[model samples]
Target chain A: MIEIKSLVKCFGPTRAVDGLTASFSNGIIGLVGQNGAGKSTLLRLIAGVYHPDEGEVLVDGIPANDAAAKAKVFFLSDDPYTPKGADVEGTLDFYLGLFDIDVDNYHRIIKAFGLPTKRAVATFSKGMKRQVFIALALAMKAEHLLLDEAFDGLDPLIIDAIKSEIISAAEHGKTVVISSHNIFALQRLVDRFVIVSKGHVAREGNNEDIGTEFVKFQAVFSSPINEENIASLGFRVISFRKVGSVHHVVLLGNNESIEAVQKAFNPVFIEHVPLDPQEIVALEMMLAKKDQKGGEEDA
Target chain B: MLKHYISWQIRKWWPMLLIFSIILTVTALYTNAFTTMAVRYYDNGSEYVPYYSFGSTTSNMPSLFIVGLVLSLVMSLFVFSYRTRRQSVDVFYQAAYAPTTIKRVRLLIGLAILLLSMLIAFLLGTTVFLLRYVSTPAEEIKNNIKFVRISVHWGMYFLSFFLTFIFVGLHYLINCFLVSLGDYTFDQICLLIFGNIFLALCFTSPVIYFDAALMKHGVLNDYMWYPALYSLGPVGPVALVTTTMEQAIFQRDVAGDFAVNAVVSSSIYALGGIGALAFNLFVPDPSGEHADQAGARNQAVAMIPHGAAAVLGMLMAALGLINDVSVLALSILPIFGFILFSVVYYALLALWRHSFRMKKFDLICYVSVVGGTLVMLTFAMAL
Candidate 1:
């Protein structure tokens, strides 16, 4: 388990992580955001790579940077480093010298991934390199594994294998926090979502809760449903599209408000369109952008 | 665990270590041969090669001192570069030990390697000399033994060799200071070159000039206050070695005075090195975030206290030198000067510049104020 308390990290004038506070229990957490959204920086802070400018990150009751706290966590960076002259076996030996890793599990994961254990990791392709680091992280059996871009540069089969391993790890009560731009991939793997925007968590919940909060609907009315009438119906429209008499609307609400919209329109045909994980996140980002522009204009 | 880590580091850089060891030994042997040739023309010269000195001071001392210094610097920088490169720091320290512990272990290991290398060089040089001496005629060997019996002792030679280790320690201290300046190739280069230059000038050139001045003023005749400046150069230690040799050869007692002076000088050097190492160990690695602003703040803060002290010290010392101002007035003036400079330079310009980002005009003002303060301090010191 990890807890962040009003954590703020600054890189020169830019605040990379701004007053972020959150708690993670033992589970698989998916961190999603656009580029430059502080997702990677947040993980680095939690891993104790960069000390915070203000506030604190605690693993259990210990400070994240403490030796004891650091012992429980492992951070697999976007580009993990391999020591000089180290092939797969040598690299494994090197890490064993530093940490008490499970050798049996290490060999098992290596075989499962089909990585060439004798070849130097520097010779491996980018995807193969990621696989090597993933195997090490899993074998280490650390209480907390913070993986940046966990599924990046991986083939479909490899992705499935890695996902299964992550699931197994989480099932054993290990905490795994994964950050990636691939929303659909995360949608399949993560039990909960943390959406970051402008160095802050814009939204956070289980996938079901997120789905309930954001909905998309399609309707066909006999008569024209103009902008004013749609506004009067009072479903906060995220996006609206019309083709002839049929209108597609993306909204922020649960089933009750979506139902109210259907009753108010009295359409010839009405269907609730289930949004995929990407669409839900995209809609939220659009809303946040709109609010920012609105605030700027008012000022 | 610490021992394992140290051994791992040593093995990791074994190739470089082996190369330097061979190079250092060859240099030492060549230097010893050159010194032996130079001393052959002087019939009264001692044939007893000082275990530390190896018989020739003028020809051999600088070269031997230099071998130790270069070996220490090269190894220190090599270890520093290997351990503190941006890539290594991020990866190696990510999951492992605390950074400070790693730094300490590397420093200790590097020092040990340096000492070991010097010991090897010394032993090899001594062996070569002994092999050459064995082939000399019995009459010549007897004559050489007489010289050795009069001018050399095991204890004096041991102390001579010990100075080389002290020089290595000083080099290590400088390397630590360079590491504290953040990880940048340009900064590292500047520090290494300038640090060597500074030490060379302090030990060699400045001492000669001071010696000439003292001789002209007959200040050497007053031994009481003269020892205060023993820390100025390599003079005191070098003189100690030379005087000990003279006392042994001539059956005199200049050893007591020169030995005390050398001890004071060496103590100052050792204490300075230890202080620098402590500072390097204590100062945390700079966080990249707001690094520029943080550096500026630190510089400003450091400058104020230093500037005030420099001003005060210079004023009092200058007044003392002129021999005009009374003791009471001299002491009071420096205190007043310290407060004035601290308020003007530290409180006003440094604080203001640190508070706000500088525009073109503001930058000009900041530079002017800093330059003006420096000029004033320089003039006062010269007085």
Candidate 2:
């Protein structure tokens, strides 16, 4: 288990990770965030690559910065480090000195992925490089795996293979935290989702919990209603779109709030719309942006 | 773990070691051979006696000193370069081992490589000299006189060996400290070059200025300034090496004095080495997040040497003006000197900060250094 408590990290004047608090246990958790949303910074912080300016990160009851704690965690960055002129064998030797890796599994994964053992990883394609690091991360058998953009350049076939491997690893009690912008890839892979925005966890839960927390409603009101009126009706509207007098609204509330919105609008016709994983994440990001703008205005 | 890391590092850096070894060996051989061939014989009445002088040998091999210095710097830079890249930083810093252990192991391995290469060259050079000595024909000398008068001075050999290691070690430590001051490799390289030049100037300029001042006051003459000028800073060790070589070749019983001087110089540099080591091991490692962000951190500390150099440079200029111009011209010299210092200081500050627009901190540091230089110049004029 990895625990982050009020973590804050800054670069110059920009706060990359600000008071972010989250916990991950033995399961695959998807970290979804937009560009420059601090996903990479958060991973580096947990990986002990960057010292936190505030708060602390605990891995398995030990401070993350401790060597003992770091030993149990393997952080595979987006652009993994491959030494110059280092072939696969040389790279493996380098990492083997640092960690006690499973040689058998490493070779097996390399063979399965059809990666050349004699060629330098720097010469490999982007997808191939990602595979090499993923194989190594899996072979490390660390208790916690932090992967940033693990599936960015991978083809669909390799994605399925890696997803299956991640599932198997999680089943064996390894806590895997993967940060990627590809929500679709993570939809079927992760058991839980963490939506990050402005360096904090804007929303976090399993699919079922997130599904219940956010509701999408399509309604045709008797009169034209602006977002202000809908918000005035006491529903926390995340997104509102109008098409030919038909309203499509995503709200952050429970079923009672959904019913209250319906009663207030007095729609000619109304239907509940279920949100997919991508839509859910998008709505959460939109809500975070709105809150940020509101806070700036208030300040 | 340290053993494995050492092995890995050595394997990675063996090519560099081999190259330096070859260069040092060739230079050593050429130096020894040239000195041996330069040996001349004089016919003194009945016997042809060999006249030996090794001062020319040390003097002829400036390349040896340069090789050692460059090897130390290049190796130190290469070894610590992992800290400058985000990817490598992640790999090494996130490893299970403590960073201190990693850094220490690297330092040890780098020093080991440097010393090993020098040892090879030294042994080979000594062997060649001995072989040449033994291979010299006795029949060529009339009246059974020795063809070469000098025997191998084992004491000097050992002293040279000790000084070589100490010199290279201190150079490595200082280079490592300077390399760690910048977040980017380019900035680190600049700091390494600028820092060394600045330090050399810092040591040598004051000596020159004071020597000139003393000469002007009639307290010292040109002949007396040589001892004081050559016996300090980087020059002191070089002078020590040459003097020791000369003493060794003459078979003089000055080993006691030589040992004292060697110890004193090494002790002073060793203090610097200790401070560098402490700074490297104690200061917080630069963040990978700031990798490539030049002048992001340590800006003030990094600028210190350059600032001091600027002040010393201005003083040197003033001293030059005092000698070349009349009292009337000297009165207005500080203003001209200050303007020149400001222009150069601003340009260097731009390079250091990587921007033309100076921050308030930069302005403050600049003003302080220029103001300090002005005050020092006034003090010198009053004196």
Candidate 3:
């Protein structure tokens, strides 16, 4: 179990992560957020790479930034470390030596990764390197696995291979936290997530609850409606994706907002959006927008 | 596993190893050719004397080796950069799992390289000596050929390997340290490059000096107090093979020369191996990134002031001036820069260290130590 609380980090004039709190235990946590959402920073803090400015990150109630705490978590970054001038065997052996991985474990992972047993790692492909990392991490037996976009740069077959490993690790009572942009793809893998918007835990719960609570009801109006009328519907449209004439607006409100939309527009297309749990990610952001710092900045 | 590590090291670096070997052999051959050519073609009657010495009465093995070593460094750089991002060669643990002690693994590999170099040097040198002896005309020349038939002594090769191993091992080990540091700037990268050059020169200079000395006596132990005594120790035995060639092959009475060469070569072998062992200790391993500097951070706040650091630095510079005013005059910028870097770094470390909440006793002790050291250094400079 990994627990994070009161985490705050600030860049010169802006707060990157402000008063955030969340917890995960014995399951996958899909930390979904936008590009500059502080997900990586949060993960690093937990990994002991970055210490929190205030508050603490913990694993099983022990301080996470401590050395022993870090040992329990394996944070695999999107950018991998390539050892200088070593062949495949040398590279693997070096890591195996460093990690104190058993000899049997080393041989097993070498074969499992599908990396050549004797070739230089320099000769291996990018996908092959990722496999090496997976193999090493798997053999190391870390209880918490953290990945930042592990799916990128992998072929579908390798992806399945990695996914199976991740699932297996989780089944052994490990906690996996994956950060990515594609919430829909993540939906199939993650059991729950801490929805982050504007640098705080805006929402944290089951996917089913997130989808039921936040609904985006769309309607084609006969004429332009005033902001007050739209506000009266007791719904909020954070942003919308436009395809020609139709605007697929995102809203954070209860299901009643659909009826309000149908009454106001009286349009031809009144199709109900089958409660897509994935859609709640956007809705969660819409709701969190209330506390946005409201400044345009890119990290 | 360790044996396989060497195999991997050798296989991947076979081209480099080949190039190094070929260059070394060619240099040895070139020296022999130069001596032979001078004797055969030079008009001077002195050239024909079998016992005639070159300009310094010492063979030019050192000069040739300088060129060969340059070639080796170039090869190493190519290897380092080309595969910098690919495979990591880590030292494994005792249980045959992954590398256990980074230092031990590096040293172990360094030993292997030393042993390999020694074996190669002995074989090549001994073969050339025997060939030269067989070709000589007189029975006495063949007998004297033993003097020139020196192979790199086991001792000299050992020393050379030991010293060279550290530099070579460091070439790989520091990568882990630099990677572990993780927050390196372009300047730091440049610094690392410069550091490597300095390190290479420091380690290789000894070996080079010994090479020069070995040319005369065909023995590694002959040269003392030469820079990189350790370096010279390893390769000294090989020099015996080069030194005795003229007397052993060309001179009619050569048994005496062969005996001397054997003695010198053996000394080199012994010293070289011992020195290589010491050099291996300094190699830094990069594999343990996480825990290596786990404590380096969170301890930056307890240090002395920049101004004080500057003054003491200048005092050291003044002493370094010796009798040459001009040398001292030109040294200002470099000296000042060194001082400035130290001062700023120490202060920064203090601040970084302070950021972590400290327990009362630890904080008090840290503050006192930092404060006291800075004050003492400043006062000494002031006086």
Candidate with best lDDT: 2
Q: Which ranges of candidate 1 are over 4 A from the true structure?
A: A220-232, A241-247, A263-269, A284-299, B1-7, B37-54, B57-61, B82-86, B141-152, B194-265, B288-383
What CAPRI-style quality would you assign to candidate 2?
medium
* Chain A TM-scores, candidates in order: 0.91, 0.92, 0.83
**A119-207: candidate 2 lDDT, tens digit per residue:** 88999988888888899998886799999999997899889888887887788889999998888788778889998989998888886
Give TM-score, chain B, model 1: 0.61
Q: Rank the candidates by DockQ, best first.
A: 2, 1, 3
Q: Judged by TM-score, which candidate is best? A: 2
Q: Decide which is better by TM-score, 1 or 3.
A: 1
Comparison by DockQ, 1 against 2, better one: 2
TM-score of each: 0.76, 0.88, 0.51
Candidate 3 C-alpha error for residue B344, in Å: 29
Tens-digit lDDT string for candidate 2 (B1-383): 55776777788778777888898999888888777545556799999776655543343244566678788888878768877888888888788776666777777788788878887887787788778767866336658853543444556556655666577667778888877777778777777776766654554456656666676677765443243223223444555565654564465675545544544654665676778878777766655676666673755666764555563564454465345333543345766766677787788778867899988988877777777777766665676
Work out the iRMS of candidate 1: 2.7
By DockQ, the best candidate is 2
C-alpha DockQ of every model: 0.35, 0.69, 0.07
TM-score, candidate number 3 = 0.51
